[model samples]
Target: MQFYPKGREQRLSIHHPSVRPRRLAVLRAAGVNLLLLQFLFLGLFCYIFGSLFQQSTHIHQVNVLFVDYDGGAIGEAVRDAYKKLEGPGFPTIIERSASDYPQPGSIEGAVCDINYWGALYTTANASNALTAAFAGGSAASNYNKNDVLTMVWNEARYPTVVDSALETTLKTLSQSARVVYSKVNGKQALQNLDTSDSTTMAIFYDPWTLASTNLQPTSQGSRLIYNTLVIILIMIQEFFYLGTVNGLYVQFKLYTSVRPHRMAIVRFIISAVYTLAGSLCTAGAIWAFRSGWQVNGNQFALSWAVLWLFAHLNFLVLDVFTVWLPPPYVPMALITWIITNITSILLPFELSPGFYKVGFALPAHAVFQVLIDIWSGGCNPQLYYALPVLFVYEILGAVLSSVGVYRRAHYASIKAESDEKACEERVAAAVLQQQEVQLVRQETLRDAEDSRSSNEEQETRDARPRRGTVTTIKDQEELVDIIRREMSRPTVESPEDRRSTTGPSFSLPFTE
Candidate 1:
């Protein structure tokens, strides 16, 4: 059986004629709010999705350094082939003189340093090696065609973008270069080579191919989490902990007992400690499933420290919003934060619209870049800018969070005082009303007694002075004095009274 009132048992449909005005008004307000929220989130999320809008069109913007050391038919063919694909909608291949990068190692260092998206280098002896193979010299039998040209890139910098756009473009350019070489030198090389030998014929068929050297190679899979998914998980963990803390405040009357300033400090400390532990776990998991990555203990520790800083910054940033924004809007703020940062780190900002360049200052992008640098054995030099940006965000979060704590405390104090004053006023009014009722009852009893006394006096008609209006006036004055004395005295509130007055520690922006 239902233990509620009869009114609760009565159910009404949405279009019921007997629905009350209050409920109907509430429903209409909720419906309007849902519609408005839909519009707001739709626009916000779409803007986030647009971060990758027509990104392929920007592929040509990537700068690739091309230095052909071999100034022979093969090198010239590759250079001309790359120049052909340079007009629009392709990677820009910038040709540098062979003398400029005298050592091949220097070119690889440039790519690792992120000076260019990728680099193509033809060995100084590429044409000489092929010519030797065709001449059937003693060293021609040991000629390695793979050493003719080299393509150097750091795939770990941004695997997805590199694999999809830059790497693909470079591979296509290499194919075009091969075709160009065949057309220019195929007939001449066939005439010069000894066709009687099977090995020589094989060399004539496939003269040269681009040899790839990934300066910073990434894992095949799973390690991708540290760059992308782990960041979101850290953010989610922070929100989950915050929700639990809010629940504790609700279940217990901690707001009434504890000072707001102290509460804020404790909150920050707990959140920091929580984030630190979570970051450690995250770092440990990464180390466990590292998939044979060649990272040293020192590098792992440094990366873990960076991850902790990143997570703490996220907590602080979210804390600022939680204490200021309304509960309903907090989720929206969360989604916006996650989406904005996630977009920045997913791809290089250079390949996106100019507007997305702001990713340089975002927390996720900075941390991701730093982590990639560390994991790739310090390939990219991004720590200088990334570290400072994170520190700035930390300072901002700290200052704003402190201010919010002070303001919330001030609001709580004011509300507590107002509630106490209201309670006192209500008590005073009730006491005055009760005193008046007793005064009237006394008057009625005195009137009945006087009437009886007057009948007795009529029988005796002697020396008895009758009690009159003066006596009644004295009693009324005495009662007024007592009430005045009680009203003048200050009332002390019990602990229960204060608890009843105090509200939740964290209030929404729209609510108290």
Candidate 2:
């Protein structure tokens, strides 16, 4: 009936007819192994992110909308010049009709919207501008304002690469045209036999010039914006992972009774703070390395706030995801990895097909733009764009967290009440069954007592002597003949009413 287990194995493996054996099932049954799962998840992200920048290039073939409103000789010459200067990596020049290019009036819109990198428009009087420049000072006096070439661009787009390419190409094209014109004009003067014209011909051919201006940053290219973005992202992710230590510590404390939203909030706070501190320290280190770390008040504040938002959003999302996802660490790390790659932090976004929506949706790309704006142009309209994406994570995630808490807590309370009520019902049923059993025992005892009393009364009746007319049978044989006849004859069928009389006429009743 009883067995005492002497060892752990026997206790753990206890098996009986009434009991099922307990065995350790797989780890996933109880949810993921947190330590292994988290390390592996983070390690995967580190490896992927660390290697991403090396494989990608900022330079890609840009699509330029080339518009020539000027059908003049200079415009035609410029087109011919562009023809000879073509290759794989060069901007693919697509000549657009005035109707085809729904060009934004400004260059900022072009690159900010990322529809096109740049637009080239030559003015209507380019040839006249060139001819006026060829004329002497008295003849060219009124043409001072007549600019030939017009170049406009989104200053924020590939600050170093795009601008450098455009600048270098324009200068080379202009200088080449100037040299050609000088040669042609020199030959024309020699053939015309005009010595005075030869002296004036030294005023180089058709003063070629490109007038460039930016729609956004009036100036450009003091730093590598993408490099800085990548560095910050690397540091941010590093600090983000570091904060997981604090997150786990806080979460362990919170495991007892923290609300889901509160947990998410706390996690975000810890990460954002850690990110800010680490970023500042990293900035200090960067400053130390290259003390030209321009301590622009606006730049530092905006960068800090933007980076903090990204870090905060990262933790908030992970906190929320941990609620339903079985392997908690994987979703966080996997999503972070995806966001990093799709942010187009390494390569130009246009290079990746269908990257616009995905890239912009990612927090990384937004933060990068915010960083660029801060680093170069104080605070700009780009900050307005970046903040909303973070706001979505904040507003939507907080709402979800609150709902998650409310629903789970509500259901838990309901389950507890149901369980309590079920226990009370079971107890009440047992008590009722016991009370019924007690009543049944009392009824059974009473019935048995009544039956015993009836049996005893019958026994008493049997023991007692007959009360009437039995002495006549005790006298003589003839007198007893009545008893014998009564015994021999048939008895009456009813005791209540006598239907028939048998042999003895004399009344002789025998009782025993």
Candidate 3:
């Protein structure tokens, strides 16, 4: 069979069975499988993460205990404050008497110890007691260690609820405490007392301040999650594209003389259409889900559009790499992973090293940054910046891939031509060799005939009688009969006999 070289006639149809079905099948399969897994995994991740965030805010309400050492007006104020802070979803605050110092059994949660300073206990006096307790035993030796223990328990839980409320209550508490202290002690006496002496004054101090440091928790935002999803989406696109291309390549190589470029283009077009469809399907799914959850429509639309663009750009880049590079899809996967990792898709752009800044120039990085902004609700100048970058990337990738396709097609054409030439050369060589062998056989037969003719001629010459020899008859009657017979025979051989006798002699002639 002759293999036709790649030409206008040898081009594969975009609608060819081998080209269409295999490409569509691979894409459809990948899209369905990946979409299912992507949604499932994303949902599970969101659920778990949201749950953890909510739980972290409720850790304080699990177990709480409160105790009151002073049952006086000052103690009542603190108790009332504790009551106002307690509720159904909050920790149970239990009040204990001084006699119950050890606090029977176990308190379900944390314990709070409130104490009051009497008139006898001045700022200097309380300071001496605190100092003495830390120093050698003195009158302060009576300072209840249990009370200190209970105070530690109170401090532990204070920040959990108190810190959350302190910002709203601080000013009011300070003003009210000042008015109360002024009425209890004349203004002149209050002025004479050290204003800095917190122990001597009725200053409302927010204990929660000491325990709570305003710190933001480290967490993954929607943008980060979205970026990760985009990475997976791109990976899925790569898989589908590779599968389709590989399938088409094998089928075309085995069955047809189509150029690689034509096949690539066919596959690319099919992939583009399939990808667009897949993107729409994925978008629809997301929209449906969002609608079911009553999520913001505008935000969902924005996110979906951004994601669709990301997917498109990703598909373009993947097509370029897959079409240009041959076999072992691992290289493509590695390159994709490297690009995504450096693009701040896996981490924050600011957190990334200076070396990775180049990735920011990539479309994927811009897309990822835009996604983060949209998810986190912030100003994203990159959204506009990324559009052009992505457009450039898409254009470049498409052009390069098209060039690769053309080159591949040319290569295929050249290769087919070379193969066909080689086949023809082999056939011509075999035919020429057979002809030369036939010629040699003819020469060998001619030589053998000449040798046989020469031997026969030598025998004929040897068998001939000498010129003077005479013949004798066996009997008189027989001799007369023989002479009569010889006389009756033709005097000379006919022209036919002469020609036949001499023909064999020269017909078997040999070369020197």
Candidate 4:
């Protein structure tokens, strides 16, 4: 027999028994859902990826200070050279007065404090030293070319941006300064120098040199993982831990026995404890392979505490999402969260578009700055700002997560009550159906008995019964036996009853 009726439209082939209308309807719905999800993620995930697009075009926002303390020809030549090279796709060179940084150490402080991506300074009395050396005295033999200019920067602030962008640009500028100094001043200075003094002549020939000072060198390669891979690892750990906790709640039916508020407290405490332990391990791992870093108790404690806060905040945010979103959509939120946070810390926000200033308020950027501060031996003094951001995230996450938990619990309770009422209604309907079946069986038996008695009465009245008079007693007896066998066997209700009796609905285990 044909499974589908004739003339009915069929999208799927008729060769398989499973290719039916109801199953096709389910497949169509699932296909639509999948298509919609693909478009949805395409829009959202692409936006996340676009955060880093064309980042090089915005490099001008990164500032490097240039100060000319030596009011001599050498300083003037270098400044003019930089001015000629100034354009887009390079760091902005902001020239400041030498008096703004009188002490040599002041430039170092400015670079280390992130006031500038780097600094270039012409040393004080550099022109005097050069002119004296040109006079062919012992000063010429002792003249140090490196004393002419100094370049200061902190590499540990952002290793990639410094090594690839800022450091390269500064070195190029330094080379240009040297070349400009020679072309503009070399001919004039040579005309005045004593040619007989060969040592003085050689010093004059190679007069311009750049003294490079990297305040905080990030030599350790492992630390690179902190802002990128390690953050992702922590997120994975939190996700699995949350899954385990939810599994336990469902496995033990804790939602029924535990109060929602109490459960929220328990989750918070446990998450804090777990994050502390994980943070210790993470910090210890760094210390174990520190590779010449100056590790100390204070740094370790600070890093551990910051990591714990960061991880716990992640957990709370995921908690809020998982509680409020459908299960199928939670992974999407997870992807969005990871990419956004990672993007915020991946590059120096200074080099990003103005729209990306939101990174300043994100937790990963703050945590990364703190870590850099700790590792660089307090080079980054932004902790006052960074720490407060983390604390604010912590406070907001805690409050929102707690409320989400309570709301989830309230919804679960209401759903459970409704399910219980539905179950009761189903049970009552089953009982009524059974009673109706029994009543129908009793009426069938009574009709059979009356038929038998009527046939017996007809036989007594005529002393003989016609063959076609009515249904025979044997037939009545057979009908009665069939009814008895059917009623004795199990009662089978209609299709609606079977559907309704499938099972009790269980609450989702996402939260309390």
State the lDDT of candidate 3 residue by residue for 1-512, as single tens digits: 44544333566776898789877776776676567556655655553343334432342233333334333332433444445555433333344544544432222111211121000001113223333333323333363322321222221111223332232232233234334433443444444444454433322221111111111111222223344554566557656775576566644562246655665567667666666666666656655544233235675677667666666666667666656655444353444444444344443322234444566676656765564445434323355677788778767877776676666666767776786677556555555565566556545645565546777756544543221122111233344455446544545658877765634221111121
Question: Each candidate: what lDDT?
Answer: 0.78, 0.53, 0.45, 0.77
lDDT of 2 by residue, 424-488 (tens): 56555555565566556545645565546777756544542232123222333343454446543
Per-residue lDDT value at 429 in model 1: 66
Tell me the TM-score of each prediction against the true structure: 0.81, 0.51, 0.41, 0.77
Better of 1 and 4 by lDDT: 1
Judged by lDDT against the true structure, how good is candidate 4?
A: 0.77
| Best candidate (score: TM-score) | 1
Collision count for each candidate, in order: 0, 0, 7, 0
Residues 1-512 of candidate 4: C-alpha lDDT, one tens digit per residue: 65545446555665467757656765776676667668867876676666677777777888988888888877787777778777767789898998898877998888888888888888888888887888787888778888888888887887866776787777777778768877887777777798899878777767766788888666687867767898888888888898787767655656766887898899899889988898889888988887886567898888898899999998888888878888767877787788788888878877666677788888888899998898778888989989999998888889888887677677777876786677556555555565566556545655565546677755544542333233344444455566546544645578979866758533332221
lDDT of 4 at 57: 74
In candidate 1, how many Å is residue 207 off? Answer: 2.1
Clashing pairs in 2: none
Give the Å error, residue 370, model 4: 2.5
What are the runs in model 4 whose C-alpha is more than 4 Å off?
1-37, 44-49, 131-137, 192-205, 422-512
